[model samples]
Target: MKKIKLLKIFLPNSLEETYSKILNNPFKIGAPNGFEPIKISESYACAKFIEEVISKELIIDPFGNTEEVTSKRYIINEFTISRIRNDHILILENPSRSVRELIRKLSEILGTRFYASAIQIDIHALSEFLSNNRDSIHLKNTRALLSGVNLDKGSSATIEITSLKDAIHDARYHFKGKTFKIERARFTASSGTKKSTIEVRSTGLISVHGPDEKSLVELINMFIAEGLS
Candidate 1:
């Protein structure tokens, strides 16, 4: 017999509890790769189906960041399943653009309503900023500032990496009169995950991993916003 499972891709670490709750719903539907939604609720059965359908473990690697690989393993942390009458209401946390698009498309086809958020920013301008300031200690200080603010206000910033050639070019041409050169740039969001570190290279790239694609896109968008602002 064919196996069945629930495969949900959410923005990394964004809606932890919300997704966990959704996973608990016995009546929740399952759709693989945009296929028709299937209803199932048994965690054990779902686990078996997931094992059979997805050969490798669900691991999201962005920008080749090794830290994400070393972090915690993926497992159902906590959940609760229940149902409500017509007077009942369901609430979901904010989601990324891609996630929203997928959900919207699914709802449209299925004749239902789904909601998601699409965070936006400019990658090119941010890249230009990092490229121009390769030697500026201020860039590092900016990271420190943002990191401190995250600690205080509880938020994240997005970042990017660049190649050495690009860094040098920006430093020589774009930031000729500037006293500082930025060696790297990174964007991130943190919620009490201590001792987080990001490394930006000269290739004009930034790397991080989300629990899902939506989270990854949100992280990238966050970095762009911070870099430009």
Candidate 2:
């Protein structure tokens, strides 16, 4: 089964001039490869603020950067995306490229200070049954896995996992009384990304947080390699 995971690196306050350059000069900054800039907005109380998503196509090592373009969407973090809390976060949504490769590339572009905090990885894996056998699945499993459970499009469940192999099992145990056809599941802690059509489908998500940067990298590597094994 193909899984979708997110790695968000929180950074310090961006230099105003740098932020401005990203917002204003997107074309020169580039994107992952074919992705174009989409306008992003922040919400507070009742007001909304629009901010340009500074972006550029990144070239993965071994492959290097390519001028060849395709329509497939993959938006890498050009700069950090800010939440209302004023925390600047560099978010890689449903990234398929190597996280380490991305980090190196971003460092070249934005410098190391941009990744001021430990990296946060949100692990996601949806059942093969979801897209393959939607009609036959039970509502209980649907609600248990997906937020705002609906027959149509909706939000995904964000739950953390301690063990990737037992993700579905954990979910079943956690939501024991809930009716569902799925046999396993897992969840993560609370946390939070943008644009592009990168879809992260999971019955549960494992969210990593805290200040321990060393352990954080280990956990990220573990999940990336063994999460789906």
Model 1 Cα shift for residue 209 (angstroms): 8.9
Question: Each prediction's TM-score against the native?
Answer: 0.23, 0.32
lDDT of 1 at 120: 25
Model 1 agreement with the true structure over 124-216: per-residue lDDT tens digits: 355445434433212221231111112123453332224333433443353344333344444332334322223333332334433333443
Candidate 2 RMSD computed on C-alpha atoms after optimal superposition onto the true structure = 16.7
Worst 10 residues of 1 by lDDT: 44-53
- Please provide, for model 2 over 70-173, each residue's C-alpha lDDT reduced to its tens digit, 9 standing for 90 to 100: 34433343322434243333444334434564455445455566563333223223433222333422211212232321222443344443443444556556
Worst 10 residues of 2 by lDDT: 43-52
Taken over the whole model, the C-alpha lDDT of each candidate is: 0.30, 0.36
Stretches of candidate 1 off by over 4 Å are 1-24, 27-111, 123-196, 199-229
Candidate 2 accuracy as lDDT: 0.36
